[model samples]
Target chain A: MAEVKLTNVVKRYGSVEVVHGIDLEIAHNEFVVLVGPSGCGKSTTLRMIAGLEEISDGEIKIGETVVNNLPPRKRNISMVFQNYALYPHMTVSENLGFSLKIAGKSGAEISAAVANAAEILGLGDLLERTPAELSGGQRQRVAMGRAIVRHPDVFLFDEPLSNLDAKLRTQMRVEIKKLHQKIKTTIVYVTHDQVEAMTLADRIVIMKDGHIVQVGTPLDVFERPVDTFVAAFIGSPPMNLINGHIEADHVVFSDGNRLPVPPDFTGKLADGRQVVFGFRADVLMPKGHTLAESGVVTDLDLKIDFAEPLGSESILLSTLGGKEIQARMHNPRPVNEGEVLTCELHLEKCHIFDASSTKNLRE
Target chain B: MSKFSRAIRDHAVPLALIAPSILVILVVVLLPLMFSFYTSFTNYRLIRPDTLWDWIGLRNYQRLLADWDFWVAFGRTILFLTVALNLELLFGLGLALLVNKITWGQRTLRTIMMFPMMFSPILVGFQFKYVFNDTIGLVNNALQSLGLTEFAIPFLVDRWLAFFSISFAEIWMSTSIFAILILAGLFAMPKDPIEAARVDGCSNWQVFRHITLPFLMPFIFIAMTIRSLDVARAYDVVDVMTGGGPAQRTELLWTLIARTAYDDARMGRANAMAYASILLSIFFTWYFFRKLMDARKHLGAF
Candidate 1:
C-alpha cells in the first residue's frame, strides 16, 4: 500500500481548462471518495491519478516517486471503469490472468492467482464462461477480480456501480468496501452519488467546477457542511436554506419572519448582515419530537402542503417565509393537507451562511 | 365467406403480392439452370440446332475426365484466388490500421480510399494491361529510363508475368472491400476494454494482438466471404487484359468456359465446366461462413 498525493493537479482540453490546479493527499489504505455533480471534474481527477489522463500541471506521487509522466501500466494502478470493462473475448479465468500473463509470470503462477481470485469472488463455476454469458453482477465481479489479481499499489474506481440497479449497487458497494477492508489497499473512488460517498468513503472530497470545496470525514461533512452546496448535496432530500438578514439579536426574512440569532454565531456576527438559515429536515421536526434536547426550540406554525409517510418517519412538505421547505415528523399522525402544524427548529443543529457569498458563517 | 376461407384468402393476398417476383425468378434463373443441366447431358452446339436432340449421356463427362487443359485452368484459378485473397487481406489490414490511427482529414482520406473500388474490373484490367505492355508500357519505359533494364519486358506474353499482372489488377480493384469492412469493425469497437487492457499492464503491441485482433476477426471473415464470391466471377478482368492468351497462361474457369461456349460453339461442354466451377465457389463460401461462425463463437456473440 502507498499514499497518493496530487500537487496542483490541473487538466486542460486545448485552451479550455476543465480541472483547475487542485491539490489532494490520500493516505495509504484510506478509502477517499471524490464526490461531485456532473462536469465537476471528479472523474477527471481520478483519471489523472490513474494515469489514463495526462497531468497538464503539477506533480502526482504514489508513495515517494513522482508519477506524473508515468503511463497507466507503469504507474502500477488498477482501475475498474464505470462499465466494468471486461474483455468480451476472454473467459473469466483468462480475464483474471491477463495482467499476470503480461507481467511474464509462469503459467502455473497465473493459474494459481486466477484460481485464488475466482475463489474470493465466488466465481468457481464461471471460470470458463465468457463475459457475455455472465450477468451484470458477475461481470462486475470479474472486473474486480481482474483488478485484484494484479496486486497494484493503488485501486481506482470511476463510478463502478452506477450502471447496476439500486439493490445491486448497494450490494456491490458493500462488497467493494469489504474488499478494501480485506486487502487494505489505497483506493480513490469517484462518484456523483452522495449516498455512495457517505456510506463508503473514509473521507469525502467535495468538488465543484474543477475546485475542491471541502474534504472531511462523512459525519464531519454531514454534521458541518462547508457551504450551502455541501449542505444541500450531502443529505437525502437536502437541507432547507431560507434567505434572511441579521437585525440586532434576531435573524429576519424578507417576509418579516424572525427568529433569534443561533446563540453560537451571535458574537461573531454584526448587525444588518444578510445570511441564509440552513437546517436539515431531520433536525427540524414537529414540536417536542426533535432529537436535539439541549437546543433553543423555536416553534412556528407551518402550513403542510403534503406529507410523505416513510414508515419510520414522515417528510412533511411545507413553506416558510414565502419559500418552500420540508420538515420531518417521527410520530406519524393523520394530519390533513393544508393543516398548520407547529414545528421546532433546533438552533444547535442549524447552519448559518453569508447570503452575499455562500460560505458558511459558522465555519 | 366462412371464417376458415376468409383467413386463407387473407394469406393469399400477401402471397399474391409476391407472385410476380417468383415468376421472374423462375424464368430468369431456374429455367436457365434446368435447361443448362439438360444441355450438359447432350451433344449440343450453338451453330447446329439439330444437335439439341443428340443425347450423348456420359460422352462429354468422359471427355472432361481426360481433359488436362480444363484441370490446369481450374488449378490455376485456385492459385490465383489464394494469392490474390491473401495479398488483399494483408494490404487491407495494414491500410485499415494506418487509417484508423488518423485523427484529422480522416473523412477525406476514407472517401479517397474508395476510389479504386469504384472503378469497374474491366477498366482496371485495361489500365494495368497498358501499363505492363511489352514496348509501350509505363513500367518498361520507366525501367529503361532509370537504367534498370535494357530490353522491353513482355509482361503479358510471359507465363508468370501475365499471371502476376492479372492478379495485381484484381487486387487493386477489391482490396478496399476488406479495408472498409475492417474499418467499420474498428469504429464499432468499445474503448473500455482497450483501456482496461492498458490498466492491466498490457503494452501497445500486446493490447492489439490479444484484444483488437480478436475483435476484428469476425469482420475479416465476413470480408473474406464476400470477396471470395466476387472473385470467383473473375472473368471481366482476365478476359480484358490477356483473354486467357499466351498458351493459356492465366486461363481462369470463366475465360475457358466463355471460349468454349461462344467461340468454339461447344455449348454442352461449357455448361458442364460452368457447373463444375460453381462447386468451387460454393466450397469457398461455405468454408468462410464456417470460419465466421467459429470466430463469432470465440467472441461469445452467440
Candidate 2:
C-alpha cells in the first residue's frame, strides 16, 4: 500500500479547465471517495490519478516517487470501470491471467495467481466460461478478479457499481467494502451518489463546479457543513432555510412576528441586517402548550400543507410566513391539511447565514 | 372472414408487391439453371439449336470424367482462389492497422485508398497487361535501362510470371475491401476493455493480441469469404491479360468453360464444368461462415 498525493493537479480540455487546481492526500490503506454532482470533475480527478488522463499541471506522487509522467501500466495502479469491461473474447481464467502473462510471469505462476483470485471471488467453477456466459453480477466479480490478480499499489474505482441494478448495487457495495478491508490497499473511488460515499468513504471529498467544497469525515461534513452549499447537499430532505431580519435582540419574520435570539447570539448581530436561519428537519417538534403558554418560547405558527408517512417517521410539509418548511417527527399525529400548528425550534441545532453571501454565521 | 383468412388478406398487398420480383427470378435465373442441367444430360451443341431437344443421358459427364484439361483448370482456379484470398486478407489487415493508427488526415487517406477499388476490374486488367508487356513496356524498359537485364523479359510468356502478374492485379484491386471492413470493425470496438487491459499492466502488443485481434476475427473472416467467391470466379482480369494464353498455361475454369461453350460449341460439356465449379464456391463460403459464427460465439453472441 502507498499514500497518493495530488499537488496542484489540473486538467484542461483545450481552453476549458475542467478540474481546477486540486490538492488531495490519500493515506495508505484509506478508502477516500470523491463525491459530487454530475460534471463536477470528480471522475476527471480519478482518471488523472489512474494515469488515464494527463496531469496538465503540478505533480502526482505515489509513496515518495513522482508519477506525473508515468503511464498507467508503469504506475502499478488497477482500475475497475463502471461497465465492468471484461474481455468478451476470453474465458474467465484467461481474463484474470492476462495481466500476469503480460508481466512476463511464468505460466505456473500466472495460473496460481488466477486460481487464488478466482477462489477468493467464488469464481472457481467459471474458469472456462466466457464473459457473455456470465450474468451482470458475475461479470462484475470477474472485473474485480482481474484487478485483484495484479495486487497493484492503488485501486481506482470509477463509479464501478453504477451499472448494476439497485439490489445488486447494494450487495456489491458491501462486497467492495469488504474487499478493501481485506486487501488494505489505498482506494480512490468516485461516485455521484452521496449515500455510497457516506457509507464507503473513510474521508469524503465533496466537490462542486470543479472545486473541492469540503473534505472531511462523513459526519464532520454533515454536522459542521462549511457553507450553504454543503448544508443543502449532504442530507436527504435537506436542511431548511428561512429568511428573516435581525432586529435588536430578536429576529423578525416576514409577517411582523419576532422570536428572541438566544443570549449567546444577542450581541454578535447587527440590527436591521438580513440573514437566513437554517435547521435540520428532525430538530423541530410540535410546540407543547406549556412552552407556548410560558410566553418565552421561540416558535413559528405553520399551516400544515401535507404529510408523508415514512413508516416509523413522518415528514410534515408546512408553510411558515409564506416560506415552505418540512419537519420530521417520530410521533405520527393525525394532522389535517391547512391546519395551523406551532412548532418550536431547537436553538442549539439552528444555524444562521448572511442573506446576501450565503456564508455561515458560525464562528 | 375468419381471423386466419383476414391475416392472409392483410399480407396480400406485400405479397402482390413482391410477385413481379419472384417471377423475374424464376424466368431469368431458375429457367436457365434448369435448361443447363437438362443440356448437361444431352448431346447438345451450341452450333445446332435443334440438338437442345436431343437427350443422350450422361454422355457429357462421361467425357468430363476423362478430360485432363478441365481438371487442370479446376485445380489452377482453386489455387488462385486460395492464394489471392490469403494475400488480400493479410494486406487488408495490415492497411487497416496502419490507417487506424493515423489520427490526422484519416478521411483523406481513406478516400485515397479507395481509388484502386473504384477502377473497374477490366480496367485494372488492361493496366497491368500493358505494364508487364515484354516489348515497348515500362517494366522491361526500366530494367534494361538499369542494366538488370540485357534482353527484354517476356513476362506474359513465362507461366509462373503470368500467374503471379494476374494474381497481383487481382489482389491490388480487392485488398481495399478487406481493409475497409476491418477498419469499420476496429472503429466500433469499445474503449473500455483496452483501458482495463492497460491498467492491468498489459503491454501494447499483449493488449492487441489478446483483445483486439480476437475481436476482429469475425470481420476478417467475412472479408475472406466475399473475396474468396470473387477470386474463385476471376474472369475479367485473366481474360483481358492472357485470354487463357499461348498454350492454355494460365487457363482457369471460367476461361475454359467459356471457350468450350461459346467457341468450341459444346454447351453440354460447358454446363457440366460449370456445375462442378459451383462446389468450390460453396465449400469456401460454408467454411468461412462457420468460422465467422464461431468467432461471434466466442465473443458471447448467439
Candidate 3:
C-alpha cells in the first residue's frame, strides 16, 4: 500500500486548463473516491495518477517517487476501466495472467497468481470463457482480477461500475469494497455517481469544473457540505435551498415570508445580508412524522402540493417562499392534494449561506 | 403446392427485381463458362473454325498433364502468387501501422496511400515497366548514381530480377488495399484495451504484439483473402513488364495460356489449362478465407 499525493496537479489541453492545479493526498490503504459531475476533472485526475495522461504541471507521488514523467507501466499502478477493458481474444485466465506474463514472470508463478485471482473473484469456472461469452458482471470481475493479479502499489478505477445495471452495480460496489479490504491497497476511484462515492469511499473528493470543491469522509461531506453545490450534490433528495435576505434575526424571502435564524447562526450574521436558507429534506418533517424529537424545532404551516410515497417514508413536495421545497413524512400517510400541514423545520440542522458567494457560513 | 405458390407470391417483387441480374449472369458468365468447358474437350484452333466440332476428350488434358513447360509455368505461377501475396501483406501491415500513427493529416495521407491502387493494373504495369526497364530505368539510374551497381542491371530480363520486379509492381499497386482495410480495423478497435495493457506493465512493443497485432489479425486476413484472389489471376503486370519473356523466365499460367491460344493457335489445350488454373485460384481463395475465419474466431465471436 502506498499513499498517493497530488501536489497542485494541473492538466491542460492546450491553453484551456481542464484540471486546474488541484491538490489532494490519499492515505495508504485509503479507499478515496473522486466524485463529481461530467467534465469535472475527476476522471482526468485519476488518469493523471495512473500516468495515462500527463500532468501538465506540478507533481503526483505514489509512495515517495515523483511519477509525473513515468509511463503507466513503470508507475506500478493498475487501472480498471469503465467498460471492463478485458482482452476480447483472451480467456478469463489469460486476461488475469497477462500482466504477469508482460512482467516476464515464470510460467508457474503466472498460473499460480492467475489461479489465486480467479479464486478471489470466484471466476474458476469461467477460466476458459472469453470476454464475449461472459456476462457484464463477470467481465467486471475479470477486470478486477486482472488488476489484483499484478499486486500494484495503487489501483485506479475509472467509473468501474458505470456500465453495469443498477443491481449489478451495487453488487459490484460491495465486491470492490471487499476486494480493497482483502488486498489492503490504496485506491483512487472516479465516478459521477455520488451514491457510489458515499457508499464506497473512506474519503470523498468532490470536484467541479476542474477544481476540487470539498474533500471529507462520507458522513463528513454528507453532514457538512462546504457550499450549495456540495449541499445539493451529496444527499439523495438534495438540501432545500431558498433564496432570502437576513433582516434583524429573521430570514426574509421575496414573498415576505419570514423565518427566525437557525440556532447555530443566531447572532453571527449582520442585518440586511442577502442569504440562502438551506436544510435537507430530512430536517423538514411533518410535525408528527419526525424521526428525532431532540432538535430545536419550529412548527410552520405549509401546503403540500403532492406526495411521493417511497414505502416507509414519503417526500412531500411543498412550497416555501414561492420556491418548491421538499419535506420528509416519516411513516407516511396518504395526504390529500392542497392539504395544509404543520412541518417542523429543525433549526439546528439548517444552514445559512451568503447569497452571492454560496459559501456556507457555518464557522 | 399452395405453400410453394404462396412462397413465390410472397417473394414476387424481390425475385422480379433480381431477375435481370440473374439473366445477365446467365448470358454473360454461365454461357461462356459452359462454352469453355465444351471447348476444352475438343481439338479446336482459332485458325481452323471447323475443328471446333472435333471432340478429342482427355487428349488435351493428357498432353498438358505430361507437358513439362506447362508444369513449369504452373509452378512459377504458384510461387509468384505465394511470394506476391505474402510480400503485399507484410508491406500493407507495416504501412497501415505507420499511417495509423499519423494523426496530423491522416485523411490526406490515407488518400495519398491509395493513389497506386487507384491506377488500373495495366497502367501500373506500364509504369513499373519503365521504372524497372534494364538500361534507362529509374532503378538502374538511381543505382548507378549511388554507386550501388557497376553497370545497368536488367531488372525485367534477369530471371530472379524479373520475378522481383513483377512481384514488386503488383505489391505496390495492392498493398494499400490491405493497409486501408487494416487501418479501418485500427479505427474500429477500442482504445481501452491498449490503455489497460500499458497499465498492465506492457512495453510499446509488447502492447503491439500482445494487443494491437492480435486485434488487427482478422482485418489482415480479410485483406489477405481479397488480395489473394486478385493476385492469383496474375496476368497484366508480368505480361506488360516482361511478356513472360527473357526466355520464358517469368511465364505464369495466364501468360502461357494466352500464348498457347493466340500465338500457337491451340485453343483446346489453353482452355484445358485455363480450367486447371482456376483450381489454383479457388484454392487460394478458400485457403485465405479459412484463415480469415480462424482469425475472427480468435478475436472471439462476431
Candidate 4:
C-alpha cells in the first residue's frame, strides 16, 4: 500500500493542454475515484498516476519515491483497463501469471502465484481456457486476477466496469470493493459514472475541465457540492438550478413570484443580488412525502408535467418558476398529469449560488 | 420428375447465375490443367506438331526420375523458396515494426514502403541484374569506391554469388507484401494489452515477444502463405538475372523447365517438371495456410 501525491501536475498534447495544473493526495489503501464527464481529464490524471502518460509539469510521488520519471514497470503499479485487456492468446493461468513470468520467476513459483490468483478470483476451473472462451464477467475477473498477482503498491483501474452490463457492473463493483477490503491497496480508479464513484470511492474527487472542483467523502460532496457543476454532475436526475435575484428578504423570480431565502442565508445577502437556487430531487418531495421532517420546510404547489415510476419511488418532472425541475415522490401513486401538488422544499438542503460566478455562497 | 432433374430444377436460377463463371473456369483453368496433365504423359513437342499425339506413357516420368539436372533444379528451388521466404519474413517484420513506430507522415512512409512491390517482377529482375553486374554495376562500383573490394566481384557469374544475386532481387521485389500485411495487423491491434503488459513489469522486448509477435502471427503466416507460393514457383527474376546460370547454380524449377521446353523442345519432360513444381507450390501454400489457421485460432480470431 502507498499514498500517492500529485503536485501541480499538468498534461499537454502539443500546445493544447488537457489536464490543467492539478494537485491531489490519496492516502494509503484509500479508494479514491476521479469522477467527471467525458474529456474532463479524469482518465488523463489516472494515466499520469499510472506512468502511462507523462505529466507536463510538477511531480508525482508514490510512497517515498518520486515517480514522475519512472516507467509503469519501474513504478510497481498494475492497471486494470476498461476493456479487460486480457491477452486473448493466453490461457487464464498464463494471463494471471504474466507479470510474474515477465519478472523471470521460476516455473514452480509462477504456477503457485497463478494458482493463488485464480483461487482468489474463483477462476480455478477456467485456468486452461483462453479469454475468448470466458463470459464478460469471467474476463473481468481475469483482468483483476492479472492485477492481483502483481501485488503492486497501487492498483489503477481505468473505468474497469464500464464495458460490462449493468447487472454485471453491480456484481463486479461489489467484488472490487471486496477485493479492496482483502488486499487494501491504494486504488486510483477513474470513471464518468457517478454511481460507481459514489459507491466505490473512499473519497470522491469531482473534476471539471481538467481542474479538481471538489474532493471529499461521497456524502460530503453529494450533500454539499462545491458549485452548480458538482451539484448537477454528482447526482442522478441532477440538482435543479433555478435563477432569480434577491429582493428585500425574498428572492424574486422572473415571473414576479417571490420565495423567502432559506433561513441560513437570510439577511446576510444584499437586496437585488442575482443568485441561482439549487436543490436535489430528494429534497423537494410532495408535502405528505417529505424526506426530512426537521428541516425548515417551505411549501409550493408545482404542476406535475410527467411522472417516472421507479419501483418504490417516482421522479416527478415539474415546472418551478418556469424552470423544469425533477422532484422525488415517496410512496408514489398515479396522479393526473396536470395535478398541482404541494412539495415541501427542505431549506437546509437547498443551495443558493451567485449567478455571475456560479459558486456556492456557502463556500 | 427424376431426383437429379428435380434438383436441377429446384436450383435453376442459382445454377443459371453461376453458369458463366463455371464456363469461364472450364475454358480458362480446367482445360489447360487437363491438357498439361495429358501432355505430361506424352512425347508432345511444340516444334514438331505430330509428336503432340505420341503416347509416351511413363517415359517422361521415368526419364525425370533419372535426370540429375532436373533433381538439382528441384532441390535448388526448394532451397531458394525456403531462404527467400524466411529472409523476407524477417526483413519485412523488422521494416513493419520500424515503420509502425513512425507517427509523423506515416501515410507517406507507408506509400514509400510499397515502392519495391509496385515494380513488376520482370523490371526488378533487370534492375538487380544491372545493379549486381560484375563490371560497371552499382554493387561493384560502390564496393570499389568504398575500398571494401579491390576487384570486380563476378556477382551473377560465381555459383553461390549467382544464387545470392537472384534471391536478392526476388526478396527485394516481394518483401513489402509481408511488411504491408503485418503492418495492417499492427494497426488493427488493440493497444490495451501492450500497455497492460508494460504495467505488468515487462520490458519492451518482452512485450513484443510475448504479446505483439503472438498477435501478429496470423498476419505473418498469411503473408508467408502468399509469398511461399510466389517464391516456390519463382521464375521471372531468376530467368532474367541468371537464366538458370553459368553452371546451373541458380537454376529454379520454372527457368529449367522453360529452357528444357523451349531451347531443347522437350515438352513432355518440361511438362513433367512443371507438374512437380506445381505440386511443390501447392504443398508450400497448403502448409503456410494451415499455419495461418492455427495462428488465428491461437489468437481466438477464428
Q: What is chain B's TM-score across the candidates, in the order shown?
A: 0.95, 0.93, 0.92, 0.95
Query: Any runs in candidate 3 off by more than 4 Å, and if so which?
Result: B1-18, B145-150, B298-302
Winner on DockQ between 2 and 3 is: 3
Candidate 1 lDDT, A1-363, residue by residue in tens:
599999999999999899999999999999999999999999999999988889999889999989998878898999999998888888889999999999999999999999988888899999999888988899999999999998889999999999899999999999999899888999999999999999999999999999999999999999999899999999988999999888887888888888877878877778889889998998778875556566677887888999999887889999877778999988777679999888888878888998888999886
DockQ of the candidate models in sequence: 0.64, 0.64, 0.71, 0.68
- The regions of model 1 sitting more than 4 angstroms off are B1-10, B298-302
Best by DockQ: 3
Candidate number 4, chain A TM-score: 0.97
lDDT of 2 by residue, A1-363 (tens): 599999998999999999899999999999999999999999999988888899999899998889998888999889899988888988999999988888999999999999999988899999999988998899899999999899988999999889899999999999999999888899999999888998999999999988898899999887777778888888878888778999986778797767666545768999998988777886676664222223233677777888888876778898654577788756577779888877877666677778898877775
Candidate 1 CAPRI category: medium
Restricting to chain A, the TM-score for each candidate equals 0.98, 0.91, 0.99, 0.97
**lDDT: which candidate is best?**
3
Model 4 vs. true fold: TM: 0.96
**Candidate 2: DockQ?**
0.64
Stretches off by above 4 angstroms in model 4 are: B145-147, B300-302
Worst window of 10 by summed lDDT in candidate 3 chain B: B293-302
Full-model lDDT for every candidate: 0.90, 0.87, 0.91, 0.90
Q: What would the TM-scores of all predictions be? A: 0.96, 0.90, 0.96, 0.96
- Number of clashing residue pairs, candidate 1: 0
